[model samples]
Target: MGQPVMVKPTFEKLIPTIGSSFRCFDRTGLNLPSRWHRHPEIELTYVDRGTGTRLVGDNIDSYRDHDLVLIGSDLPHTWQSDQYLGRKYDRHSAIVIQFHPDFLGEQFFELPEFEAISMMLTSARRGLWFPAEVGEQIGAVMTRMTIEPPVLRLIHLLEVLSELSSCPSAEPLSSQGFAPSLTSASETRTEKVCHYISQHFRNPNLSHEELASHACMNPSAFSRFFKQSTGKTLTEYLNELRIGLACRLLMDSDMSILDVSLEAGFANVSYFNRRFRESRGMTPREYRRRYTEATETSNT
Candidate 1:
């Protein structure tokens, strides 16, 4: 019954246009709190600026300016921007497109010539990462889509997907177990559990019993089921979740070590320090100093 993570959307009030059930947005001047949320539509995102880590399903990777990614339906993801990269209003721009599988119609994909695209879509279940060059090329098309006519937009999308399917350097970003699915009772419970943990990572009072209750399951059953689903022990996963939050805080906020310890959910400063060192192979202060120095050097 480790705490659950809640996935919140950055933009909620702005809905897309009619006839275009799919939506696209350019996110700037904002940052996301880490959580896992999903929808039934596939997502394509291109980051024009900023640097941080991206978590798609169970895969975690460092992302720099100009990262392009495609996430399949129901794949959980978050784009975490570091503090240094968040200094300017327009410095973190991203192009995000969301569309259903049948948006182009079922018959479009069934055509013999679309076999590669079909395969690519199937493979997209695990998420996809494009090389910088490919990203740049695909990103150009996405940018064009903002101004193109309906018919031309479809053509551009087809070209982009074709290129993606043929690109040799593209890699899968999510773990092998990262299966795509519509939200169900079990999935909702899992999502709730993940969200709670993410939000309360710094709260020492949080426990498995409390989490199990949130999911409406017995403590023993919840513990066993969570482990089976995530491939990690309840405590271990919670610690990792805490550490992940701590890492983000360390890089994004000026909060001191003691404050970070409490904010990330360790009961005591000493235990937080010990676990931080054990999990990251360096002291909290040391990790921050090194990471900051490295970022500064890169910028300079």
Candidate 2:
């Protein structure tokens, strides 16, 4: 098999090219997948308007307008925007800052005054999420960054980080399982497997043999490795993926339960009904009805 294609974030597209040093600025109206990429530079992102899901390492979470997050170096991550909101709301209107720890030299973080900032950086290796109020404050600072010079922008960026470090409510997104590993090849291979699964969840023909072949591993090894890495077996993971898609289709499409199940990759109605109930704790028809009723209530 060919070597897996691992995606990494490219800094070439940002406004005012960041050097091999610490930098800060605003990036407005951006919509692009960074892919399964990583870099040496740590990133802080604050979104202004959007609703989507974020995949940071192995953790998946739903995000909406005003979501602010910080990610560490060489940890795989991506954001997928909701298809319906793509045109109505700008997907990537936000502020982004990237900086290397060495930008301030090796001794800067060792100082007593910088201890909290240092800890924050270390904690961020697993990713961090700022609370709503703090996110708003960070978003405001990021908005101002677009108008400031490099020097002032960097200063304000430090202030922002300082404030974030002190916030008692800041939530860590990923834990030890999501920490960055030094092997790029392994990371890329893992991402390849995940992307493949995401794209093909609706295909009933998808099998363990095919996925293992795609990852260039034998079936048993791939099964073991995948479970160890993701904390879920291939069968369980694929079912969850399919059920997630089914849930969305149930809410958005007018298809019947049997058709929805068949479309979502189940072999037959009985099996689909059984699996759907197991995964969601409810029948597909009931889920769809409740979801539609809830949406109607919220709109009114």
Candidate 3:
């Protein structure tokens, strides 16, 4: 969702330093790397600063400062910064930690002392997201690990994991029915179609015929292939992307509802309102109000 880029998720190979079984990176740049990639290692990522779209497995959403998420082994993911937001900082900041599931030892997490964390790892197979406040609380520890000695970093890593494992409010990002297709490499045609959709979804005149032509398939065949590869119909996928963008606009700007609807590619205001309520369980105004109130309270 970040770039007009879509492809079979490339497998990334990571090598840990000589003394550590895990790797940590504290990165700052104009934007985070927006690769649709996967790896054998599980990942914990905290966005110390930035606003952007987050794609994990089959889930897509907007993320803001203090964002935190855990990606299970081999889950495809990337974060793309919105060029329009937070330009004053001229940089995006994040800390990433990656480790094998058995980084500690084959049976380390199997012990009673790690019962909760073990359960958490299992749940992270679908991707786990913690509240922004959780990120704020643990960000300093993660930041320190960037420069701490190996043994000290390992201690802090466990402390961070222990705290996260005890958080009851962490939410799963991907749906229960969603599954990553490691075999996606063989689906180049589907990837091309997806890439095109990502770029043109905001075009109100976008049509199935046009997309099918881009994929060089009949509309009927394209529909079947897209559904099989992504577990979502074209309309369903487009709506989700638009809704995500709408939510971001609601939170980041004072755009009127009609303006937000049009900017997000909806042709009609009524339809946008209906779909927004269905997805958010509230009107756009309500969603904006709630987010604003929560942000103000946090600031206070």
Candidate 4:
């Protein structure tokens, strides 16, 4: 095979023009894809409306209106909006702010006055989700930022960060152990490998040899590279993907355990059961029941 075609993750280059410290996009009403992309800039996003799955690093969860999040530089992420999944009327909308770590100046955030905000940005490497109330408050300021002059908008961005630093409810999204090695030297190769896995992890017959060939590396070398790049063995990575899919199916579908196992690419239901228990600390049925109870309780 003449180098199997690779679908690499999109690298967004959002360089600002002359005299601009950062970029703000007020996407008032828009529908976008679940396109997995990354940039070197830290990002703050506020969802004004819509609901869907938000994926940051290896973390995947649902998001609704007034959702707000901060993503660190080079973290692969995407908001798979309801509209992107064919819920056409559920138009997604958000305000996105992007800036380099040293956008103001190389040592600006290192100053004593910026200590709290600086620490918050460091924690954001794993991504952070703010409560809806915080989202609403920050969203208003971000909305105004769209119309404000460049100088004033820069100041507003600092205010936003200052407020976020003190938010006690800010939750880290991605697992602390989940690290993506997307350095410039290996980014394209890593992105190709990751994107391919994302697209093909559902194949029960998916083999290491196949993946190695796709990445044009020998099996042993590929195994080491994969571990170093993603911090997981190939099997471990695939199981995480499969289990995540199974969880979603359990929550959103009425599929039987056997069917869920088969659909999620496990060769047998017995193995699936064992792996599910290992990963979740409970049987899939128990997980589903707990999730159902929680959902119903919230609804009530």
Task: Tell me how far the alpha carbon of residue 166 in candidate 1 is from the true structure, in angstroms, after superposition.
Answer: 4.6
Cα displacement (angstroms), candidate 4, residue 242, comes to 2.0
- Per-residue accuracy of model 1 over 1-300 as CA lDDT, tens digit each: 443345544222334566455676676653544445666678889987666557677665567667999888777677755543236323478888777788878687879999998888888888899987788878877887867666676677778888888988879977687453333555556666765665565578888898888878999999887765454557876776667667767877889999888877788889888888988999999989998999899899
Query: lDDT tens digits, residues 1-300, model 4?
Result: 233355544688988756677889866443433456789899999998876567787776667779999999888787755432224534456899999998778999999999999999999999999999999999999989988899999999999999999999999988888777767646677667765766566789989999898888999999998877666788987887787778777876789999988887899999999999999999999999999999999999
Once fitted onto the true fold, the runs of candidate 3 whose alpha carbons sit more than 4 angstroms away are: 1-9, 29-33, 85-90, 187-195, 293-300
User: What 10-residue stretch in candidate 2 is worst by lDDT?
Assistant: 7-16
lDDT per residue (tens digit) for residues 1-300 in model 2: 234445552222233355324556555444443355667678898887766556665565656678899888765566655443125345467677877766678788778998999999888888888876788878898888767877787788789889888988877766576444436566667667876766566788889999999888999999887876565678876776566657766876888888878777777888888888997789999999898898899899
Q: Better model by TM-score, 2 or 3?
A: 3
The window of 10 residues in a row where model 1 has the poorest summed lDDT is 5-14
Q: What's the lDDT of the predicted structure labeled candidate 1?
A: 0.73
Give the TM-score of each candidate.
0.68, 0.71, 0.87, 0.77
**Candidate 1 runs further than 4 Å off:** 1-22, 27-36, 47-55, 59-67, 77-94, 105-116, 131-137, 166-169, 179-183, 228-233, 250-263, 267-297
Question: Which residue pairs of candidate 3 clash?
Answer: none
Among these predicted structures, which one has the highest lDDT?
3
Cα lDDT listed for each candidate? 0.73, 0.72, 0.82, 0.81
Give the lDDT ranking, best first.
3, 4, 1, 2
Which of 2 and 4 is the better model by lDDT?
Answer: 4
Total backbone collisions for each predicted model:
11, 2, 0, 0
